[model samples]
Target: MTSKRVLVAYGTEHAATAGIAEQIGVTLHEDGLDAVVLPAVVLPADDVDDVRSYDGVVLGGALYAGHWRRKAKRCAERNADHLKHRPVWLFSSGPVDSSAEQHDIPPVRAVAQQMESLAAREHVTFGGSITSHTPGLIAKALVRHGKGGDFRNPERIQTWAHHISAELAALN
Candidate 1:
């Protein structure tokens, strides 16, 4: 059997989202799949290789003001045709607390809706992190409003990654 390759693409502002994408890629690799982690802004031109080159895709973005970063949105839109035919999963990282999990709702519905046409296997909302060193005035303001700190759960993230690996393995 041929090996499967998965693309773990993400958009991040402060780099936290990039870390998540990298971790997912590592998990996928350890599970016997080839995974590449790349920023949405540089997802390799569809004309060069196309999203069809990958067996599956994991797309994620950092949420701000109840919306995903534009680069992530654009990446999906640019590759919608080929992506629609592959196994896709979506994740959004946001929320100063674990409220997204408790409420069972995405931090940004519009962001989730963007994947409606792709028939994604799952859409997850993970807790986000903010630090005193967060960049930008708006981030500073949000931090001042008690939205700062590390709320992301590494164990939760790993569990989700394992789930993806298992699902892909089953498909293979």
Candidate 2:
């Protein structure tokens, strides 16, 4: 049987969200799914392949000031028709602390609206990172203020990916 094709697309500022998306893609690929990871910015362009071609999609974005990145929002809006017909999951990457790992963080208002629009299966909030390497004056200031560290939990991310794989398996 042909493996299910899954798209893992994300929008990131300092690449933290991209790291999470790549980890999800790797987990899905290991579970026998054909996973393609890409930046949200490219998904909306004319030259890109249609979102309908994929059997499922995992869309994620970096959260800033309680809002998802613009590219991620635009990607969801542009592909709303196709995404609504498929199995879709949404995620947000933010919270520079352990809050996400400590508890279930609900999606922000905009993300929730997108989830409703796409009828997404689930939405997860993952902890973000702000390190010395993260560019931007704000990031530097945060780091200087001792609020910088990588908070993405690999085990949690893999578990979610496995859940997605199981769901897709059931669909087939």
Candidate 3:
């Protein structure tokens, strides 16, 4: 069988969202699927051409003040027609906290309704990285970010990967 092509795109200000997208692509690769994780800012034009090139697309990004990254959202809106017709999934890497088990429902999550409400097969919230842990994101000259390490749950990521894999399999 021909390997399936999946585009996992994310828009992030500091790279936390990009980290999550990369992990998803790794998981999909483990399942022997053709997956490419593209940062929304650097995604190639072919990434949004049509549904024919990819079996599925995963839209992911960070939420700030209750909204997905603007560029990521626009990418979705532009491809709304294809997303509505194909297997689409959305995930947000936000809700900052120190514990992986803590599922803090940030009030800002409501702003992501557009992606969830617009015919996506499913959506999930992820524990985001702490600014304390990600030092390189800000500035390295004057002072180190002073901290590093994401609080996001690896277990939850694996579980979501399993779910997406199953759903994509079902489609094939």
The digit string of per-residue lDDT tens for model 3 on 79-143 reads 77777777888878766655435653532444356556567777777877755434553434313
The best candidate in terms of lDDT: 2
Q: Write the per-residue lDDT of candidate 2 for residues 1-172, one digit (tens) a residue.
A: 6888888888788789989988999888889888854323213222334687789988899999899988788888888989999999999999999999999999999999999999999999999999999999999999999999999999999999999999999996
Lowest summed lDDT across 10 adjacent residues in model 3 is found at 37-46
Clashes of each: 0, 0, 3
Worst 10 residues of 1 by lDDT: 39-48
Name the better of 1 and 2 by TM-score.
Answer: 2
Model 2 error, position 142 (Å)? 0.5
TM-score of each: 0.86, 0.93, 0.76
Candidate 3: what lDDT? 0.67
Report the Cα RMSD per candidate. 3.3, 2.7, 4.5
For candidate 1, lDDT tens digit of each residue in 60-160?
Answer: 88888788877677778888889899999988887878785576664376566766877888888888888878788877887899868777777777888
| Greater-lDDT candidate between 1 and 3 | 1
Candidate 1, residue 69: CA error in Å? 1.2
